[model samples]
Target chain A: MSVAEKLIALDPLALRADFPILAERIHSKPLAYLDNAATAQKPQAVIDAVTEYYTHMNANVHRGVHQLSERATAAYEGAREKLARFVNAASPREVVFTRGTTEAINLVAQSFVRPKLKPGDEVLVSTMEHHSNIVPWQLVCEQTGAKLVAAPINERGELLLDEFEKLINERTRFIGIVHVSNALGTVNPVRKIIDMAHARGIAVLVDGAQAVPHARVDVQVLDADFYALSGHKMYAPTGIGALIAKAEHLEAMPPWQGGGEMIRMVRFDRSIWNDIPHKFEAGTPNIAGAAGLGAAIDYLEAVGMDRIAAYEAELLDWATRRLEQVAGLRIVGTARDKAGVISFMLDGVHPHDIGTIVDTHGVAIRTGHHCAMPVMEFFNVPATARASIAFYNTREDIERLAAALEDCRRMLA
Target chain B: MDLKDLYQDLIVDHNRRPRNFRRMPDANRVAEGFNPLCGDKLTLYLKLDGGTISDVSFEGSGCAISVASASLLTERLKGATVEEAEALFADMIPLLTGKLPENAPREHFRKLAALEGVKEYPSRVKCASLSWHTLEAALKNAGQPVTTE
Candidate 1:
């Protein structure tokens, strides 16, 4: 059967059973969670994995020789292997865990990019980047006296690829951009971006916080110098994320933090750092969180990323048509190739008001700047209400969201 | 619970053609508040006399809720003292948020009570409160200009 037919035949209510939180109500109504872009709800398997780790094998990893300690270390390292396989990283050593994407970007900015960037060097980021992507580059530029340049996007939220190429030159040291825009769901052409930057001997960092959850991402295929993702965005718990880098880049980066797990040997006089991933991971890691992330990856693999992507794409196409039928409703990001995120604003109605009225019928969505202020500015809107979907979201959910939005329009009008 | 209770004819009328919805030429405090999360932005100007809000006007951009709420706040505080205005602003928290507050001074928020429609929209509570937050900041910096994030 075709993916759309499979999705149509699939009962999302049954799929919702996998997520215990989906059963709960928001504002005394069924929680119609359409805010997958912000953070996906965790499944029972991921929750169980985390709980089981804390219950049975809670101990500091790589430090102790006891049974629980060894088990904990194995589980932690096992998660690393799972992540390495998930993103097609060269080795587990290249996968360094941080708090989330923000910290990962900060790590790259401080350790990798900052030292290399000179006063006149330029770092090119896109207009559609999240504040996380924009702010770090700004910080690095501020610290190093380097210049931060923005590559503009077209009206449809597509990056102006030619303009992006123009931004790259001998003065351009690095190009950092979001693989998929969190606000507009504009899936960036990162392979071309990487190739363009690479030809000019410029490093590239792809913020994959949005893409990794919906799409099958092979960082190796992209050949990106640094790729970062948040585990929470992929149905895992918050506070755990990964940064995959080439082993050489990992080795070259100065240690981001100084503490227990990251240090090889410590003294008052001098200290040597651990190798690769350990060199970046400073504190006692979020071992249970990592285990949860592993479980999330396992769940996705079981479902199959290709199947999930196809199902979600069908949903996006369906939702796009459905939402367009609503009078006064205008979709913000109309990129030719995009993900399941639908950001829209109803004429004469505030997005927050729309969000509230929709929730009365138990339809949940995100309403805000989406942390991409520049994208909002590009659209000349203060904010928009966004509905992002996952594989589990059904056509019925879209109908309900549409119906709720219509009801909201009438009630407000 | 219905929008009718919050977006009353009077509030709607004011939102449609807000009174004193212009910049104050001789204003004591002018401030802007922006809720970056939701893209709500507002600029407020308050003319004070000793400790009382003598005249107030505003000009900015935001959603209807913010624009309406700012209109309501301006009308309610025209003749109110600083303490009374502050107390009224404090009393509006639960009404605008649609949350039942323990020991809420709901009686004191008579005119501002029109914003009860905002409760239905949890996300927009920030929009409705944007003007009040700016007012609070403007009140504190009554003699000097202020702004808020």
Candidate 2:
């Protein structure tokens, strides 16, 4: 990347206009929707794509021989191709449609890892993973007598690479790590982690639910065995996400769910599974959601991920410096490499109270453990108010958030 | 809704210096409560003498609404009978949920009305009512933990 390219910033006004809900008023104040980590607001293109699907082609996919079925199937599978290309996958056959990242990780845990696990085997994850990443592995471990070990992290929320390398051993079978911490906004050194695991011939699953929207991900470059992501986090519809895996792993694993779409033939005594991607997709899939996701990928590509990543890095640097000026305010997760998230707490205020006070000024920030309870426990805070940035957010939105905090401290703290 | 309505002076005062903010060693009944949404927690302790409630206290951490609600309830219910406390808890529910009957007597919710502002923010109502729920749980069954969910 060139230095001039690094200095380029996206036009915030134009980007914000693409999202209709950004103009909404909360409590008669302009909505400063900063809760991007919870879920991102959709662009009009994605909304229109879903509406167009239901309006014109409302039919079950891959079932009927009629014209509508072909159109629906084309739209759905086209989304798979778009997503596969988005992550630079080897082929669309490796992409398996699931409800979201949770189901994607669970499919890999039960289908791929469960069959390979023996008693006393270990599946390693980091201390900063969302509950989605941790709980699925724990469920699989409980059934197979495998142990779940978490690699430690520092106060800065960066993963301890030395400690993580020490934990890898002959008994370790799999590694699940988050590409970015939702609670802390710390982007993990996943490339190094993947190389470490691959050196031991172990499969690694990267939880890309938080990473894909912020930056470009190339599965071939990282050589990750599996990558899971949520569409809603990437400006697509909810209940639509995908698991992109290596072809060897996908073909070798059995189907975790059994139903109509995943079957080649079902006899009374025996059943043959379908091909690589379809083998995991059970029952009728979310067709309209797939159309919306395809449109979301189109919108993101046209905007350019490099431009978004650079703009957000500048925005995060600005927010961190601005927030540090507030009295008695502490910013958690000061990783050297962070995305556009800033989790913070006031000296004497609880996060819930801070959340309420900010909402009165029409700033929407998430206040909770963010489904990363272990990270919160590590920091010794019950919760933190998180302001996650996206391409559409601007300086004015962040100003409203900081001002609301100042008022809250004066009134309560 | 205005921030002042929810975070009144009285609520902030009670939260700053919570009354009886310690575990009771001699209490015969205890119940722990958790509000998962906000990570607020409270443990209510009770001492019953014969058929009357002799003492009430709580120890925990929460937002201004929950802490104030618990402190105010302790002040109101320290000398009341167990049956009276249960009746008060039952009557206060409608007010907290913003469904109080038009002609209902004021005595049922007069002392607990500081928490009525929570009804405007439906999500925070769980925070304010969690302490009372724990009290009811402590009275009906002594040791089981409670969660607002």
Q: Candidate 1: deviation at residue A285, Å?
A: 0.4
Write out the backbone clash pairs for model 1.
none
Please give, for residues A289-331, the per-residue lDDT of candidate 1 as tens digits. 9999999998888777887888789889999999999988999
Top candidate when judged by TM-score against the true structure: 2
TM-score of 1: 0.92
Best by lDDT: 2
lDDT of each: 0.86, 0.91
* Each model's Cα RMSD: 3.1, 2.4
True lDDT of residue A43, candidate 1: 91
- Please identify model 2 stretches exceeding 4 Å from their true place: A1-9
